[model samples]
Target: MGYNHEYQLALANTEAYWADQADRISWFKKPTKTLTKTDFGTYSWYADGELNSAYLALDYHVENGRGEQVALYYDSPAAGKKEAITYNQLLDRVARFAGALKAQGIEKGDTVLIYMPMIPEAAVAMLACARLGAIHSVVFGGFAPAEMAIRIDDANPKMILTASCGIEFDKTIAYKPLVDKAIDLAEHKPEHTIVFQRAMVKAEMNRDGDLDWIEVQEGVDPAPCTPVKGSDPLYILYTSGTTGQPKGIVRDNGGHAVALSYALNNVYGMHPGDVWWGASDIGWVVGHSFIVYGPLMGGCSAIFFEGKPIKTPDAGTFWRVIEEYKVNSMFCAPTAFRAIRKEDPEGALSHKYDLNSLKWVLVAGEKLDSSTYHWLSDLLKVPVIDHWWQTETGWPMTAPMMGWDNPSEARLGSTNKPIPGYDIRVLDGDGNEVEDGEAGNICVKLPMPPGVAWSIWNNNDRYVSSYLEAFPGYYHTGDGGFKDDDGYIYITGRTDDVINVSGHRLSTGEMEEVVSAHPAVAECAVIGVNDELKGQLPVGLIVLKAGEQIEEEQLQTELVKMVREQVGALACFRSAIVVQRLPKTRSGKILRAILRKIAAKEQYKMPSTIDDASILPEIEALIEARGAI
Candidate 1:
């Protein structure tokens, strides 16, 4: 039950391994070349391949007679609706949208920006772009006009797709006005704007360029799939940059399809006709891989959930959806489990559903603490797979690839072993391999897997300098961790997230793990704050379980003692304070950098992705009360 054979085979000859994966997808011209390298730190996989991403994801399944099976299950409690679309139906919608785009003068290689909610139209728009061999860039729906403008200026999309309104909780937020503002702000205005009229709110449309979505698709025929080279760009997903500009991470057509198709069977244990649900938004990389392309490539069902994890109803929302849809496997962030645990500590709401159909629950986005991992695993009686990857790398780099014949046991804190085709290493600052117990930078030897990003859009220099130049022949992950003697990788924290106390490096993740182990603590975040004496100190911001109470002095003492006993005195973990909630992005990633800024009383820019901007003031108040500000 070890992955030694698979891992060894892939690393021995990556070209052979990736070539076999490429064969899994249907192609017009099968690739004769596996990978091509350049002197400027760039690579192209399946160079001579000719295939359309949408054709493989949609047409292949329908031609194989699996069209009757469900392909998209959309449930939006906030919109007060629920529906499912079969493979045939999904294909028709995507094709019509593709035809509409073509009719508007969009051609292969053209870029389109899609900004919509968690509705099925978002997925359709992405597929439509792929079907016509056009690149699609999807921006998160909650983004403001200013934020949208920044992306529009960067990509200069030919067309923009959006909806009239998006429902969050019970409120209907208009999106058209924001699109119009972004168009006005951008130096390059899109030629056409297609609007999906939900009728939830009144929206003004510009007569010169705006077109109703329904009218555009009224009499158009489905466009034929365009066969592009394997290296053709599929999408551009932007990630936050340190220099106040976004990094446009580009995914190619052939390699992405091949890698994801391989993962459907190997990483997810998925087959045709099965249901897979990934409760992530289409704007992010996770949604691009899992919620849309991955499941569709496997000819399986994927859910598009349009509701908050907690406030949409209760912590029971996920369980109810599972029972209703009979979901086979589910994927969500670790913060979700923390929220569910906060609401129902004793499994009161979870026990109501029959999760027997749920074989696996995967957690990502952030490190899954040992306490939450064990709590939810025991409740569901299923393997809680903690996988690790980034936006640049489309799919998981480390995971416990489960199987019916040989099941893998859950390793509480580890993200299990590195997946095949990924040669993971822990290296020191000088690029030397570290001992098993020592923490260092996590890196991957070049060339990376097929699914890994080939380059940053329009910025080959940045791609080389950002990932390659840091460590000569390695892709610096920007994360710090260690590999155990048994080959299990434990991600300690981001290298930037490490706290330097009197020149001793202390991982905030390790400190957070110790503090979160306290029985009364529901969740906690550890941050490093500058100090005149120690240089930096670890501060714990805790959120206790519902109705749980303890004296502030006594609780702080307990938390300090826990860290001292576990991580030693060098941790400098003296302060602990309570907070009602932590600031997070809509994707459930904690805003630790913001917390660190508040702790050190340093100026910080407010991110537009924050779920609740109001909670930021609360954190500031708590910091001020503790004299840390």
Candidate 2:
């Protein structure tokens, strides 16, 4: 880690380093001036910047008094539900939902849509539409209501936020009739539709005049709206496309609250109150910036959970809510520690209780596996970290800076550093860089830092053909991996989840490490599927372990002779199937593009919080009664 030439001169002091992280939070009216710079092929950054972040994640902790502390701690799954709110009840439910979006006209460059779940009144309707300057977009309550009518008809929103159904792992669902069928086909519709009932069983609203957020905040009060800059537009997340289509990745508002309080306090070092949980499903993009605006702009108390970690009422509800909330930074996705180490491994998680207040578990969207990183780091002795970022690198552009770093400086699989305010490179396919230990095309060389992701919402030629003309001035993070000899990075997954075959491109994490070192393998995905004679081969599926029954033709001939003798034969196995569970993403990501769209029969959308899409119709009826291999 020698690159500390004084933290590389505090990482090349970008305009006095993000204006001293925009004065370490707490800014109400301030923002007449700050960042506004430009170019990574010229657009601009900190560009015309000015601050707000709902005045630094909720009226600067209640205009500095720290308003009764506890900023938000919702819970759900019906059994006596839960709430918490505070930071003055999150500044009076984000100023009476920003005075019910200015009594419905919804001003400041409109566009709303938030599409609920992972409730705290859906983060008080996304901080009351950023306390009124509007422009949110959220979506991800497991998408698919035609992927929420394709981002509610491409962000043609005008206020939509919802609820009236939420429970997971057991199913209640509703979601205000898929936001009233995406506001009755929103090419226009969203003139208002708030909802927020949260599992209000059999809930069927929109009986007529859309707008009932507890009857419009029952006689409003907290007004405050109109104040935006730091390049306004603070929302719109939508990216789960599994290789194509879904885009809309924008981000703004004081660079998404100073790049999510500078990457949730320097990449999961998090602090303030620190309960900080982020199982991410507030509809993706790490549940819209680390489960609701980076742990409430870092005041910290944040842990929402409409429940689902292996059936809501089962498989140890995320170690029973981190042993009833002593949680201390547990972020998620390693497809959920390989589905809870296949239903509680030896860490039996202290037999279901007192989790010595967890301690920075992190891991993200994909690629943690070094066997789910030493199985949740030997069942929570803690320290797992492994990040990597996307949805156009809005937040974590690869992490591991947790105080001088430590996940054994994570090499066995990577995504370690370069998040001190992003500069990560790694190019190839003709952009340049890639030298140290090869594998490239990861790009980001811009002045784009503060919550990166800056285009695609209004589609500037799809933010310049999906991230800057493929690889021109470098932004092309369509996944690929690299950096070692001490830089760290390591993504190795989505470069269209690579798999060439006859030409041998490989990597479904190198055939999920030879079918997770076989012996009746338990957790696997290694997709690519569709192969007439190897256009894309490697397909493993698997689930086993408990009671371990081995015999899908002898575990698919020992996972196709252990990937044709450890990593060869174009990484064999175009089929293995056997599953009891895999679907994941209650913050344990493995949907393997839904087993590569059901082994390429195609047609896949599924997302509505997937606690179990009916165990994927029994793993797609055991892969159409196993006939093809």
Candidate 3:
């Protein structure tokens, strides 16, 4: 079926359409009621169904004669390791770990917090929690103790699973001390902490509840998959909130399984034996959906990578993995490619390996700029699709359906049309629809499709006020963008990213598109800074390509001219600052919010998710040297 036909069918009869999609997965107790409205004014999918996510991801595939198939290819240049785990092998580890958890008093519906690095064991720990019908919350390894404490208080898990340390390039960050500090700071502490000891570092076992991972599972019997209601919570992923506190977004079992299965087959065009690599950390939603669950559930080999895009020995690591594992489809953030491009401007490193096996490259987590998009497309000669979604939505909200007979054409700055089951609309502040090609608040008309977070964990009221209250009868995406006349959707960054110059509203994303087009520019971020007369003005922070040198004054002149020519002088984009690096989250999203805080000289708290906090001071110094706009 074509994209239009499938999309129309979904919108026409959401229940019937989803019910058919639900049948694609192996449900223990198949649901007759597909979609149902709750008292909280939200919808739930497959509410009456029963299934085990871990079962569908592991045992079912093994039962169907895929036992020997490699389910995960663990590649970690940072740690100097490589291992391929088959379905049978992974299932064994998962079941044994589930038994270990069961022995430690973990039961169905209980939550277990997992803080580990990008390793095969991280996948095992998550699957083990799912196998016991327990909800797992994964905090990115190396997060600050205060941040970890906040999550610990929110989830209030019965146990915490962590590794001894996490390796970043040549640095070995001890995880035990951080975990210990968080436990001390948190009001509610777990009963026990299971520590996975790696050879790189050994954690102190002085804590009362500390338990060794291998010792605990030595003689434990493998645990069987426990049945769970479709509406039962699968995981709680915390996304940073504007109010300093983080919101724990909840994902359910049945809908999550069904949506991901459908997405893998249709959205990404993955086959049973294909190698799928999502080069993102397991702490994020992308890793939870694609790197582990989606690929394993769809019978594909997932690459569990623990390395950087540029410096875990150069920009060629990605290509090496693609060639080594014969990866068919890969997914990551656009920042990764920009880093690779900045390091290897001529694409010299990529030529060393065979990347012909890569069919599709999908990027998300942030907007994909036109220059980076073109660079990747030209380098790979494959479909470089920029899909859009958030932590709330587990899968793509907008993407090109590669499985369709006639998918929409890939646009430069657009993320293509809305995926099936998402009724996307561009609306103004008053909640009225906007004209085609006019920028407005992007929203999805309710009820939102499955795989979306049904509610914020332990805070239903907050969920409503945060998403639904902004616009009645629609889920406010918190993003600003427009739909083209041809129906392709372009995301203009977060709604807050829209800056007002005097009275005219302009998207910094659009200005960023103009600035990044310069040949000397590799990656850039345009943020709104305080302006007494104009309300807010846009400023660009640029990182030049490797071996490219231009005087700061000359580069600034060129960028200002480019923005004026492309976005008009009304954009008020006069300032351009050259910086060695931009502060970003570990997930690779440029910390524009923090930059705004710095530019305005407002007091701001250090973000726990920042990849390098030291970069913030460097950025502040550079901005100070440039004087006021």
Candidate 4:
């Protein structure tokens, strides 16, 4: 059957279809009911099943006699480290760590805080939590003591797992000092602080509450995986904290396993022994799902890369890793490709490596412009799949389900169609379904699939108000996009990203798309600033390709004319500033809100997730210069 047949079947009987999908995993106690709606306006999946996420990810492969196969390929160019751990070795480490955690009074439902860089121990810590049935909350290593303190206060973890230092670009930051400061700032302090010496940065440890990480595991023995109810939470991953306080997104054991298992095999078209690399930081949801858990549980080797796309060596870092590992499929952000293209305009770096091993390229996190998509696709001669999902949804909600029988051609700039278990729709202001080409709020129909979050930590009412209340029974995605004729989705940025110029709502994504199509422009971001006359007007920030330069006045004129021709003059697009780089979060999301705040001269708090805090002053100076012009 084709896409239509499978989609229709899923739509007709979603519960039964999802039930069949759950059968792909090994459940200790099989579930009788697939889905049940709670009174609080959320759905629970695989309620009666019993299983362990760690066992599925580690033990199953070793038990099947694939002991010698590599499970994690550790490469950290910044830290000057490289190693490979097989499935059997990984299982031994995980079980030993679980036993150590158990010795420290960690029970099944306890919480553990993990604050470390993209190291193998980070994955080991997460899996140890899973093996012992504890809920692990991993804070990004770059976060400040204040930011880390907030999550610490919320999760109230019994233990904090961190390393001596984190390697970022050319600097090594000691993590123990930050952990100590956060513990002081937090209302609740963790009982124990486990410090691993990665950088040998000479970190101070509290004699009473701190323990050396190596000491804890010296005499520990491997422990058996602990089974949990299907509804038991696997982990709580916090949002990147772009807006208000971050919401703790909870993913359960059984549903998460089932959904991701199906996604890894069916959606991405991978099987056992395939090498899938998700080039993302482990702090984010993508890393947790695809990089560590999803691929491992799907019976494939997941690459844990500890390096950046450009600064690690050159623009060739990604290709080198792929060639070195023979990576079958890979995932990265659009920003990464933009940076690489900016550095290597001739694509000479890509020519050096034999990228024939790559089957496809998967991109998410932001809208993938048609220009960048074509640029990469033309070079690799492989299909580029741009999928869309969020921190709340644990897996891909909409992606090109490349079939085993008859695959569909990937439509450029479209985020494919809704995946099997999601009933996605675009709705108008009044909550009615919009026309095919009209942009509206993107929402998922009620009783969201299993892999979705249970609630926003302990704030159920906030979860209801934040997602459910906005669209009634639908889960409001806070995104504004339109569906094409063939059911493909064209995401037009977030709902707040829409600018009203003279009462005409225009998407920054549309303007950015036009600007990116410029031959000289490698990447661009568009935002609306206070126009005083038109309510708001679009201003573009353009980053040119390497070794390509044009007169500033001429560039602005061409971009203004292009926006007028494409989006019409009501866009009032006039200012286009050439910048060295756009300010973005660590996860590579452009800080448009920060840009808009700077343009309007309004007081705005700097987000802790910003990749480079120095970029903010640079943006301010650029805006001031543009205002003078």
Candidate 5:
């Protein structure tokens, strides 16, 4: 069936449509009810179903006679290692790890925080958590101790799983020190810390609860899959909040399995034994959904890459992997392609490898500019699909479904039409639907599709206030965009304080918190400015205290160091300009929107509510002098 027919059918009979999709996965106990309302008044999918996510991803495939097929191809250029793990082999490791966790008192319903790099063990730890029906929260290995501490306090995991170090380009960052520091800072203490030691760095097991990863499973038998209700959370992935605190996004097992399976077959058109590569870090939602759970559950071989797109060793690395593994489809952020494009403008490096095996190239995590979209399409000679979704959704909300008999044509700067289950609409400030071609708040009508986050971890009120309260009956996306007359959706960046920097969603408020903490700064506003490679980069505009005296150069250096030390290097907050004063409204709210426009060199009118109109030119002059753009 075509996109229109399938999408209409889903909306016409939401329950029946999803019920059909749920049948694609093996369930321990099949669900009779499809969609139901929870105590929080939000909708949940497959509430009566019982399933084990790890079983669907591993054991199910093995039981179906695909045990010998390669499930994960471990390619780590950073460590100079390569290996292929079959379904049976991966299942054995996961079961043993689960057994280890069980031996350490990590039973069902307990939370486990996994802090590791882009290695196969990271995937193993995550799947192992699922095997025991534990909720795993994977923090990006690049985050600072302070950032990790916040999550540690929030999630309050029973145990922490981490590697000794993470390699970034040429530098090997020891993670044990960071984890140690985070645990010291956090109020809640985990019962145990399982350390996965790499050859590059060996963590000193000095802590009272430290345990070796391999040693813990030595005497334990492999554990079996633990059955769980469909409403049971499989994992808690945190996303940056405008409040400078991260919000945990909960994904349920049954909906997550069904949605990803549907997305793999319909969105990307993958089959069993097909090689799929999601060139993203496991910490992000794309990694959780595509890199680990999605492909494995779909019975496809997934490449667990541990390297960058340009370096480690060249711009041709992605092409080489695709050629070597014969990857049928690959997904990554537009920022990666931008980096490769900058290094190899002619796409000469891509031609060195046989990329004919790569049928589709998908880009998400941030807006795909028209230039990058066209550049990739022309170079790859394939459908370069740009889709849009968030960590909360767990799967693509909109995309050009390649599996559809009559897929929508690719549109420049558009993420294409909504997927079958998403009823996406553009709304005005007053919560009314906006006309086509007019930029407005993008939202989804109520009873959001399966796989969408049901509630914030431990804070249902925050979830309701953050998402539902704004639009009464819709799930506010926090993104600004407009739908074209042809039904294609164009995402025009975030509508809130959060910004997407190189596919990583970070909060400007969080950066401001770090910047304002500097002694020389009285107040500061961090705005995301447009960039050629990173999509958006954080630029800090600061106002000094009345008697404080410091050179702009010195303050900039100090602020940069402070932000890096506090937020993490992934923030990319290098630019800081000292301003005499900040433009604010009469109500005392800083005019950040004006600052962003000024930094982008875009035209803007002075707001009538501005407390001081002349501050705009002064801010613009300072930003220009600093070359922050």
Candidate 6:
């Protein structure tokens, strides 16, 4: 690499690089200066003074007169009804709602729970919390009352927001009634419950003090947002709970400001006026980061879709949206793509729409295998970007930044290169750096990548022990990475998940990628099961593509052989069990931990973040079917 200021400066001085990026944003209580030269990765940042996040997001655009531009394109699953809110319109609703929150005696530092679908009001609720300097915790609309109750009690939020229903598979389900039940379970009664009337359902308030969402929006003047400290918590996003209860991942305003722009421009390669759609739910980090904050902070159009893919009257729903909106960039998951391929395999996508505008595509959540990357790349004729970052990381820490880096030489199975100012590492159990070709636990050496979370919401202990103490001074990623000989880093597997079979270590990701490549396989996840003979064996679970009939014996032989060929026999998958779908989080990560418990004959206390957990029963049946063999 030549004397690229982008590389030499960002890579050499990671802290200063991020601090410099912070300068690009408006700050009220400006940070005195960048991270001290000595404190490297231990301190926090932005201007020293406090600032309101909603002001930066909603007001800043309005002050600049860019508020008239489309801030959010809201959609409902209901037919022929969509609402587009410009920044100014959105700001008015948020301000008044913030005033309403104040009327309920809500104050700074109080937590507000927002559980609504991808409607215009959801964004308003978020900004309202920001305007009031309250921390907002957004739960997926589909969550059960028991799940919602857990989050409410954890945060003890002063208020809760919901609606009557949300769209899934073209059907409407009541959301407010369940919320009414969830509020009953709260240890302390929420000061106010704001309910948006989707589906025009009659309000059934089990709680007497609950406020109708429609009435609240009726008569109130928008209040100017109050200022908040840069370090004040803006939002608390929970992690997908495949292993246990979801942990609330909190990110402050300064960190979010620095991160959102980086991810939008660096990962998605989004430019001003570009139509970008992130097919992620507003409940998850991807939705909060990319769908809303990323595009907003970058000053671009962030498209929001309200319905499901396969159920919108055809397999081409996403494609239709793209064609309609001229969406130039799209970010989704391999699971979503695979689901689409099931509906429109064999150039069905190429047949219908004018998709020529699509320029860049990014995939995350689950690992984006080489198969899906090439398939979408060839299918769309766009650069396929594979990225890696966890909910805790706050923003994408690794990717081939469009202009700053080259993707033509991008490494397969690798999450491209680290973003401008991140020091990504693969360190061993001893906390020492691992060599090329050697896999170790991934960690961020202190200060952290800009989007790196402030902590797990308010539970500082879990945050410290979960990340900080796990690897001593470094922030443990829990995932593993191996540097290639030439210095590119490839994610191998989660450290808690890598299988040790007969004394040889193997990456479940590597094994699954190979199994997925076999002609008969559609998708796969590798899990290590306890074996009396070998301590553990790598059993593979897979789903086959439609009409591509595959025999158990033939697939077993071919899938195992393929893994051996690609990653070595030491990493060969022991057994192949075909299932309809692998259990996963809404974020798109495979629930390998759940798979482990099931394989070990342990009962699973399923996490709240998994969307289609009913699919797990099919997995059990598939495993049982192969037991006789």
Query: Best by TM-score, which number?
Result: 3
Question: Considering TM-score, which of the candidate structures 1 and 5 is the better prediction for this target?
Answer: 1
lDDT of each: 0.89, 0.70, 0.93, 0.88, 0.87, 0.75
Top candidate when judged by lDDT against the true structure: 3
lDDT of each residue in 515-584, candidate 2, tens digit only: 8767566577777766687677776778876667567778877778777887766566647877776887
In model 2, the worst 10-residue window by lDDT is 38-47
The order of the candidates by lDDT, greatest first, is 3, 1, 4, 5, 6, 2
Alpha-carbon error at 521 in model 1, in Å? 1.8
lDDT of 1 by residue, 1-629 (tens): 34787789899989998887787789999998999995677788987899999998899999999898889999998888898999999999999999999999899999999999999999999999999999999999969888889899888899999999998888999999889988888888899999999967866876579999999998888998999989899999988877767888999998899989877778888888888999899989999999999999999888889997776788898998999899999889989889888988887897789888998899898889988988988899888899899999999888878643554556777888888889999999999999996899999998898978878878888889889888999999988999989888889878888989999988999998898888888899999888899899888999998778787789999999989999998897999989999999989999998888888777888887888899989999988888865
Q: After superposition, how far is residue 456 of candidate 1 from its true place, in Å?
A: 1.2
| lDDT for model 1 | 0.89
| Tens digit of per-residue lDDT, candidate 3, span 530-556 | 888889888899999988879989999
Clashes of each: 0, 15, 0, 0, 0, 7
TM-scores of all candidate predictions against the true structure: 0.98, 0.34, 0.99, 0.98, 0.82, 0.94
Q: Candidate 5's residue-wise lDDT over 1-629, tens digit each?
A: 78888999999999999999998889999998899998887988998899999999999999999999999999999999999999999999999999999999998999999999988899999999999999999988867788888899999999999999999789999999999999999999999999999999999999999999999989998999999999899999988676657899999988999999999999998999999998887888889999999999999999999988878899899999999999999998876776576567778898788989988899887556555676788999998998998889989999988887778888876889999989999999999999999877899998888999989999998999999998989999998888999899988666766687999877675576577556555567889888899999999987665456688889888888988998899999989887777886432347777788897889876653355788999988887777777
TM-score of 6: 0.94
- Which residues of candidate 4, in runs, are more than 4 Å off? 240-243
Give the clashing residue pairs of candidate 1, or none: none
lDDT comparison, 1 vs 5, better candidate: 1
Residue ranges of candidate 3 with Cα displaced over 4 Å: none
Residue pairs of candidate 4 with colliding backbone atoms: none
Better of 5 and 6 by TM-score: 6
Candidate with better TM-score, 1 vs 2: 1
Model 1 misses residue 448 by how many Å? Answer: 0.4
